[model samples]
Target: MEIKEVKQRKEIIEPLLEVWQKSVRSTHHFLNEKEIVMISQYVPSAFENIPHFIVGYDEQKPIAFMGIDGERIEMLFIDPICQGQGIEKN
Candidate 1:
């Protein structure tokens, strides 16, 4: 697996959105379908506003992503299948 910064946020928004939704659903059991859909509406804009964006790839396929603002991590979502694989620590 390789983790790299994404210069163009657009390049990873769609794939990361899929990762974000899948991850949220799998882990955020308190959220309902409607709530998830509502929150998803803002995901792309959030990506746009993030100062630093990075993605993790496995075999050149997107598997995880993070959005950083200054020294804080604003967002992080890993594909459900890929979680617990040490990608976050990497």
Candidate 2:
């Protein structure tokens, strides 16, 4: 797996959303659609002057993603299939 900073909500959101929703539903048994949409809409601005939005990929496919909000981590999600691989620690 490789990690990089992602810009452009339009480019990163769909993959992030897919992984996030799947992971959440499988693990937490709940769907936070409104929160997900808010995050999708807020991520770009959330990183306006910050470093990269950490995104993890495997075999060129997006596998995990995280957003930084100031000094805190606002969101993190890895593909449900990839959970035990320590992708989130990246």
Candidate 3:
């Protein structure tokens, strides 16, 4: 996998949104389908304004990503299919 820093939100947001949704479904049991859908509506704005964003690509497409604000990690998601492969463990 190749890790990349994203300079344009548009270049990464759509693919990473799919990653975020699947990752949330795999682990965020507190959220129902309706809540998840509702929350996703704000994702684009957040991604666009986040201080930093990066993605992990597996040869062809983005499979994982993280959003950072200053020193804090604001968002992190890994495609459920790629979870546990330690794609971001380092």
Candidate 4:
């Protein structure tokens, strides 16, 4: 496994969005269907504005990602299949 900085936001946007949606659906049950849809509409633009992004990979497959803006973490997501593997800890 390895962690690498993401230099191109567009390159992984699709997979990143997939991971984000799956993660949110599994974890953020407080959000109603309408809120989920609204947030979904905004995620892409938010992703575009993140200044720092990194991805965790197992071999060549991306398993998790985190986005940072200065000191605050804007996003962190793991592929549901890869959850509980402690990818977030490292």
Candidate 5:
């Protein structure tokens, strides 16, 4: 797998959203659509001219993603279809 850092939301946010929804589906009784909308809305403003996203892909298809905020890991999600493959272990 090739790990890449993507800075543009237009390029990365959709995949992030896909994983985010799947991860939260079972636990959240009612998914907050507005929260996701807010995230998409504020991502551009939240960017700090640094690498905030790490995407792991098998060739061209993304398998896992992580959101890094400085030294803190803010979000991590591995595609449900590809879990248990150590994709998110890193």
Candidate 6:
């Protein structure tokens, strides 16, 4: 496992979006299906505005990612299959 800063937004946007949807669906059960769909549409553009983004990988596959804005963490998501593996804790 390794953690690294993301230098290119386009490179992992799709996978990160998948991770985001999965993570949100599993955790944010309060959101309706329509709400999820609505939010999904904006994820790409919102990600582009994140000032600092990083990803965690196992081998060559991305397992988790985080977006930070100064001292605040805007987003942190882990692939559903990769959850509870302490990827976020590290």
Global lDDT of model 2? 0.71
Maximum-lDDT candidate: 1
Candidate 3: list runs displaced more than 4 Å: none
Which residue segments of model 1 deviate by more than 4 Å?
Answer: none
- Deviation in angstroms for 42 in model 4? 1.3
In model 3, residue pairs whose N, Cα or C atoms come closer than 3 Å (at least 3 residues apart or on different chains), thus clashing, are none
lDDT digits (tens) for residues 1-90 of candidate 3: 888778787876778789889999999999999999999999989888888888888886989889899999999999999889888885
Give one digit per residue, the lDDT tens place, for model 6 in 1-90: 899888688877888888899899888999988999999999988778889988898887788888999999998988888898777888
Q: Answer with 4 or 5, whichever has the higher TM-score.
A: 4
Tens digits of per-residue lDDT, candidate 2, 1-90, equal 999887765666566667776777667645476765665565455545445578789988888877786788877777889989777666
User: Which residue runs does candidate 5 get wrong by more than 4 Å?
Assistant: 26-51
In lDDT terms, how accurate is model 1? Answer: 0.90
Q: Provide the overall lDDT of each model, using Cα atoms, as 2-decimal numbers.
A: 0.90, 0.71, 0.88, 0.83, 0.66, 0.87
Candidates in descending lDDT order: 1, 3, 6, 4, 2, 5
> Which digits, one per residue and each the tens of the lDDT, describe model 5 over residues 1-90?
888887665665565666666655534546586765565555434433335887788777766777788899876767777777676666
Q: Candidate 3 or 6, higher lDDT?
A: 3
Model 3, position 40: C-alpha lDDT score: 95
Kindly list the per-residue Cα lDDT of model 4 for residues 1-90, writing each as its tens digit.
899898777877777778788888888999987888788888877778889888888877777888899999988888888889777888
- Tell me the spans in candidate 2 whose CA falls farther than 4 Å from its real position: 30-52
TM-score of each: 0.93, 0.70, 0.93, 0.85, 0.63, 0.91
User: Candidate 3 versus the native: TM-score?
Assistant: 0.93
- Each model's number of backbone clashes? 0, 0, 0, 0, 0, 0
